[model samples]
Target: MDEFEKSSIEGRVIELADSSRREVEQEANEAKAEQQRYIAELLKNSSKTPIVVSAVLTSDHQSIRPDVLQKYLDATILQASSFSQLCEQADLLNVKLIQHGMAENVSQSLDSRGILRLPVIKRHYPSLVYESQAISGELAVIDVISRLNILPIKRFTAKTGTNIGNGEGDGYLQFQLRNMFGGGEQLKLDITKGTKTHSSYLLDYGQPVTPWWMLNSMLFKNSRQFGNNNSIDMLIRGFRTSLRSGFQEAGAINHELFYEAEWRTSKLLSLHASDTLLFQAGDDIKSSLGHTLAVDRRNNPIAPTSGSFLKITNELALGKYWKSQVEFSQNNSWLKDDFIGSCCTFRSGYIANLNSSKKTVNTYDKFHNGGANDIRSFQIMGLGPKDLYDSIGGDAFISYGVSLFSRLPIKKWSHSNFRLHWFFNGGKLINHNNAPLKSVVTQLANQHSTSVGFGILLRHQVARFELNFTLPLTVHSGDAMRKGFQYGIGVSFL
Candidate 1:
């Protein structure tokens, strides 16, 4: 009985071995077929055959004329070594077309693929060089065809919002012209008006001179009214030209070199305006060249959960006035279960009348500390020396702030663009009095105002809003401090 069982098991084992052998043979055949396909593709792309583009065709589009399309193709598809390279050039041509506003969508036509595979007699393609007998043959000459669809080259947009932080309303109308002169040049016009910003008109032009750089020019006129403690109105008309690195926020550093010429006029809106301000009130002309360098790696510019940002600026005006500013902020999140995080920021600036003939820097060029957009619990332009009701602007200033934030506890509100934040802020602004910059910084560090607050933060695509209930922890005499609920809004926040 044992011998009989052994024979049966041997038979079962033989049958299983046969099945495994067949499976192995099938896989080997499949792999061989795949290898052949890869070799064919490699050979097809490795060919050094010269291919002449016989003709180029594009889909009919109303916005772009046929001659314009032909001109672009003539410039880009002038030469290609192989069909693969031809396809690559064609793809790049599509990109160029889209960039120049000739079309938004450009794709190789299926007919081009068909033509590549078509069997042709020598008479049909007398100048064409092709290896038709080879398993991996390449075509030498071919007509390229593509489909292109047009896109509008102009746009108009309007934006309006209530300034919950400043108790005001603001709105703007924007008009944009794209690809002006068929060269990816753009012109934009903005008309803006607000309660605090009385009115502004801007005409901006930009050209992408290269992939990495942009040239920009702006003509602008602005009128602003400071209604609170400053009680002053300012008007500015300016023209600016700049070469800037492309706008990108994802851990990229950007730079700008600019020249600006402006006419500035200041008028006192209140009869009781300070004598310091009164002396500064008048029309002045300024011409300056400046450079700005910035590094932004923040997850969100409006309300970052992580990463950091930094910016530095320097300017020389009329060759006798100099200014420099540095701003830095960082955000971090330690809790994994919730969006609990902290943000810290520091800002400082210096301006000097390098001209020995002048005694003071222009107020328009000086730096001011404290605002809804800057250090909290203090009025706009509220820090530093005071003359009457005016915060008589400082020639140098430094400010810093820290905040801790968390998402709302409610599960439904976890993904909302709202969070609770507690903050501590402090800063000082002072005239340098011909002192060394290090000594001035030391003075700022020793003598500063501070405030602590808790606030609800609302993040928006256009701006961030904060409503904080604040208390001044340390006060400086003559500083304008806000003691209760304060609403703040603008692009940058501490």
Candidate 2:
């Protein structure tokens, strides 16, 4: 061969006249596109097709009895427009079913030795398919996952705290059982001990009456020591039942209707207790029906920067007595973010003993005023009438407070849970024994004690603490005063 003809070709090319690589690739892509379009059409048509969800058949479960599961299934109405919709409904039903099963007291996966004998879910859901449609257009199959092994439906918690400034400590232990009988019922027991509250024991039981309502019953016994202001000890044991509306969100209005029966005893803690306090000491029984309505919208309850709160309560006791109380507070932020804020609060209460034979109301049922929680410069229950050295409480009272709050100036501490607080408080407490209601109200408005203070405030999870320098601006003869620095710690404050 000639040199030109013999020159080696580095690459070889094979070409078919009927087909090329580009054409082949384009054909393959077109086939894939057609297949996808067909699939899309099928899915669209299937989604619009009618389907019937005639029944929901849950798998066998050992923890929840068959009859109980059946009742839950029967209560639910099943309807669906398409297979996908049917699946959605089945999912919701499955969730409820699992919850009901888990609430049962029986253990499904545990054996005698406490070892897992089977898969938790498999034990609860014996069959993978929860519901199967029959004799209809396209049948839908839904699988529900159920957990047979669950944590015990009970819990125990302990809370402890101390106020080193006051040399006081408190602790609480609570035990709760959830769904005790598999009907969404709960039982709780609380035991408390502290320096101020000598001791307390309570048993509470509650159950959901509706999605937005609950029924609760409680038995409680408490012993509390009133310090210098009263120098008395009080014991109250009571049984109360109430129906409460769920106020799960801010700004929601809530109502509570309750009936309470209490046995109360007042005893002197000091040998020099006042004659009025001694006269009020003894056993008393009260039966009352009451209602409480509240609307709260605070952004943060611990240290509110915005919104308002209002609560009104009324009680009727012994077919002869009437008591009413109202409380309100409004808070607003004056500067951007949480740098500064202001709050206004008002509280008033009245008790009337309408018995034609009796002139005095129960001491424990009367209103007591003056405290770090209320008027900062006064001792607890100190602003009311006093017999010798003890505050005898009052039949009618009115209190109001105005407060300004700001964050620390340092950049590093500006966002901390510490606040500078300035406040003005004023109130009056009237005994008004056998006095007309109108006269008592007039006295409550005309005679009062006033105080002003500034303090450092610390907001804690369980309580708010304050170190304040308080000055009594105005005071009556019997109103106890605490000038200069005062320390306070409590869950509620004005």
Leading candidate by TM-score: 1
lDDT of each: 0.75, 0.72
Candidate 2 lDDT, 1-494, residue by residue in tens: 56545453312233443357779899999999999999778757655444433334333344344555455444332344444444454444444443432342322220112212233332221222336654232233333222233233333334544434433567777777666555556678888888888899999988765435678999999998764543788999999999988644457899999999999898877777776677778887889999999998988777778999999999999756899999999999877667888999999988877883754676567888877888889977778877777666787889999999999999899989899999999998887766887787678778679999999999887688999999999999889888888888886677
**Would you estimate the TM-scores of all the predictions?**
0.69, 0.67
Off by over 4 Å in 2: 1-154, 158-169, 179-184, 227-233, 248-250, 267-271
Q: Per-residue alpha-carbon lDDT of model 1 for 1-494, expressed as tens digits? A: 89999999999999999999999999999999999999778648644434456555544455555555566666555445455555666766776666655455666642343234434342233344447855433344444444544454443344544433455577777777766665557788888888788899999998666544678999999998763453789999999999987544267789999999999899988877777767878888889999999999987777678889999999999755788999999989876644898989999888876874665676667788877778888887778887766666787888899999998888999879898989999888988766787888788778689999998988898888888999999998888888898998778887
Kindly report which residue stretches of model 1 are placed more than 4 angstroms away from their true locations once superposed.
1-154, 158-164, 227-231, 247-251, 268-270
| Highest lDDT scorer | 1
Q: Flag clash pairs in model 2.
A: none
Q: Candidate 2: lDDT of 13?
A: 33
> Which stretch of 10 consecutive residues in model 1 shows the poorest summed lDDT?
118-127
Counting clashing residue pairs in each candidate, in order, gives 0, 0
